[model samples]
Structures are given as C-alpha cells and as structure tokens.
Target: MASWSRLGRVGNLAATIIAVAGCGADDVPLTPEPGVAARKVTVIRGDQTYPMTAEVIDWETRPHPQVPERGMAVHITYRFRSTSSDSSAISEHVELQACAVDGRRVVLLCTSIFNGSSKDCWLGPSADPDLARTADVLILPDQMYAGPHAGDPKDHDGYVPPRNLGPGDQL
Candidate 1:
C-alpha cells in the first residue's frame, strides 16, 4: 500500500512538471519572419569580374525560434567565392552590385564586405525601394567599420558594418 501511494505521488509530480513546461512554452516569443529570399550578384576586382553567390543577413530577426524580437533586416554575404578566388581577396576591398533576378537595377554602394570578412552593411532609416539603384562596380581601399547590428545610429550613414562570419553566415 505504501508503494502504491509513492507511485501515485510520483505520477502527480511528473504531471505538474509537464504542465509547467507547457505553460512556459507559451511565454516564448516568435522569431521575426525573414524579409526576402537571398539575392545573388557579381563581384569585381581590378580587371577581373565573375559571378558570385551572396545573401543578405538581417539583424532584426531572432536567431532561434524560441528567441524572438532579436533578428533584424536581410543582408548579403560572400559564399561561392570563398572556395574560389573570393577567399583570396580577403583584406582586399571589392565592389558588388545587386540586380533583380530579372537583371533590373536595384541599389549601389561602396561595400568592403566582399573580402569575406565579418563586415556587414546596414540599410539606413532612409532606405527606399523606389530610390534603390544597382550598385556600380568599383575598387577601393580596405575600410574599418563599427558593429554589425542596426542598433547603432551611425549604421544609417551609408556605411556597411562588420559582423562575425559565423553569426551572420546564413540567410
């Protein structure tokens, strides 16, 4: 009889634990949906030009589904070139232009993130889709940037920020 009572108490405790866990799950927030699918572009260095794969990394979005309200806007990164000439361009600043899948004009800016470094570019508060134009291919010197997140007020000043490669490597 004593053993039966103990078993009953254990069952009650297990049920209470599961109920608490289920209730806590509801408190968790939802991750912000990714803004758009990754877009590809070509990278140009000096006189050489080639097709390259890149994706935009958004900072406003949450990293994990359990942790919402953390992620941000979508951005781009160097992926294909890493195994090719892209990795060799490390520390060498290059320019990349974004074109619509249909090859239409989008937006252009001096980006140093092409070197496959942690650098990231944050779209400023004034960003407008209508005004967005395809980036002009050009060469420039290496530039040092601040943090990779959009929380920085300076990120809106037309400068691309840098972030750890691992954290922002994926779409």
Candidate 2:
C-alpha cells in the first residue's frame, strides 16, 4: 500500500504544476505587496525592496520523495496568504532553490519542487536564507548563485543549467 507520504507527493506534484504556471518572481521587479508596509531594514540589497511575507523558514532536510537520495537539503518557503487557504494546495507557492548573497544584496535561485523534475527557477532578493540574512529586495538582482540548498553536495545538480536562472535568471 502506498504510504500517506506517497499519496502526499502525488498530490503536491499536481499542486506544484499549477503553481508553476503563475511564476511568482519575475525580472520586471516585484513591488511590495500592495497595502502591506515595508518591513524595517537597516540594510538594503539595492534601492529596491520586495514585499514578501515569510511563512516558513524550514531548516529541516527534505529529500525528494521519489528519489530519497536526491535533494537532502534545507529550504525556506514563502506564502502569499495563510496556509489555511490551500485546498488542493492548489494554493500558490514559490520555493527558493538556491540563493546568492553579495552583502545585503540577495538573488534567490528558486524552484517549485524538490525532485529534479522542475525546469523553472526564480531569483531575486528573496527571504533571508539565514546564512547571511540581510536582503533589501525580492525582485532585482546584482548576482545569482547557489543559495544554501544548492550549496548542498547532494542537491547541487538541480540548481544548474536549465533549472537555474539564465543570463539574468528569475526575479
């Protein structure tokens, strides 16, 4: 019998597919979420600041459900709204894959899945990776590279080539 965990993976895959279509981050620059006021920051990545509410900063090691040998790395999850809003989890999500930080400037190399199956990447001064957590923006980049997760030995492959940002990858 398939474990509940297995069923969960199948479910999350469908949800992730739908979420990917939205493309949370972009090169055009993400404005602070409308009415939400900017958080206080003594440090700034540039002149820009993105409005992102960090829902979960997971430090736990999560591996690929299919290939447990893959993606044994930590990641952070950001949500546009409360988790309760998710139905099929058809809820919206933007999972940052890797991130590069140049001082206060951060360029998150993001993805939608833990499996090496996704071909998408989103980057910008996303939520702090906590390694060097001092970002001032979430939609612009000075540079992009391996954030903490991509820095992991087992998870590095997913953050390269087609899965990562291009000349100027994701937002």
By lDDT, who's the top model here?
Answer: 1
- Local lDDT at 18 for model 1: 91
- lDDT by residue (tens digit), candidate 1, 1-171: 999999999999999999988986854443332222234334432234434434443232112344324432223333334435555544444433222111232232223444445545433222223113323222222123322542455454334422222111222
- The weakest ten consecutive residues by lDDT in model 2 span 35-44
Q: With candidate 2 superimposed using the best TM-score fit, by how many Å does residue 139's alpha carbon deviate from the native?
A: 8.9
Q: Taking the tens digit of each residue's C-alpha lDDT, what string does model 2 give over 20-55?
A: 876755422332311211221111123422232222
RMSD of 1: 18.8
TM-score of 2: 0.23
Cα lDDT of candidate 1 equals: 0.36
Q: How much does candidate 1 score in TM-score?
A: 0.28
lDDT of each: 0.36, 0.34
